[model samples]
Target: MSADTSSRSSRQDAFDPFLQPELFEGVRSRRIIAFIIDAFVITLLTLGASILVFILGVFTLGLGFLLYAILPVSVALIYAAFTLGGPSASTIGMRAMGLEMRLWYGAKPYPLLAAVHLLLFWFSISLLTPFVLLVSLFSDRKRLLHDLILGTVVINSAYHRAYTREHSAAA
Candidate 1:
């Protein structure tokens, strides 16, 4: 579902997640730290894969440098697409950071939407524009433009699963 921009309802009722403020709170500084840790791990894996490709190229094959250039990007895109669309609904980095991805409906996204989200993320980061990073400053939930475009939200996975369990139990 799209963000509720209707004026007919009270603002508080517009966003379902807002009904439970604690869910949003988990996206704080701690998640950022968890993200950093995940990024480091992904980077290391990318580097190792690159090195292997390079060594293979050295053994009478010219595929090493090619892999060096393509592998990292591929790994990154695949990571983005799968995680954002997958059960966890976040990247490995996001997951490690205790964050998870969610659709506007508070559910997992379809694969196609996830792919688009991943593409937008890379394109935005590649541009390295100050405006992109600054979008969070103006956003109520600190979401980037790419996130807004996809109608995806990143919340703390730890918090989300717990919240889901508790709510389910109550129901």
Candidate 2:
């Protein structure tokens, strides 16, 4: 009768868009806002990292200048890995937009998964550009290509996670 056992019994009870439409309400728009905010944050972080790399280049007499080539990507991966994999499962930008990402099977995302998600995003955008985002328009859950590949969904934080928390608390 434990919550964990009950939840496991319903592994098939995935958050159904038909059953709980609230979860998907405004999700696509919210996701757009979240993406914009996260991009801005990543840009700011990249700028800071660029400055550090410049300083390192000065200290190392230009040897560290090589790192400048990879600094933005490294900073992005680290930021996404730690923040998306953190307790809230959201980046600072996501938090600002009141959104969170969750695995399709009702588990939290881990750092490795988060980092892979980010990499896939970059790859998909590079290859598909405008089409990468269009997939969400056709998906019931508003999942993009990387999301479908990773079995993840982004949800509004102001809604039903509290119901999940209460369900989980009984364990």
- TM-score of every model? 0.74, 0.89
Model 2 Cα lDDT, one tens digit per residue, 20-135: 77878888887788889888998999999889889999999999999988888999999999999988999998888888898886677999999999999999999999998899
Task: Name the regions of candidate 1 deviating beyond 4 angstroms.
Answer: 1-17, 26-28, 110-112
Q: What lDDT would each prediction earn against the true structure?
A: 0.69, 0.88
- In model 2, where is the ten-residue run with the lowest total lDDT? 8-17
Considering only N, C-alpha and C atoms within 3 Å, which residue pairs clash in candidate 2?
none
TM-score of structure candidate 1: 0.74
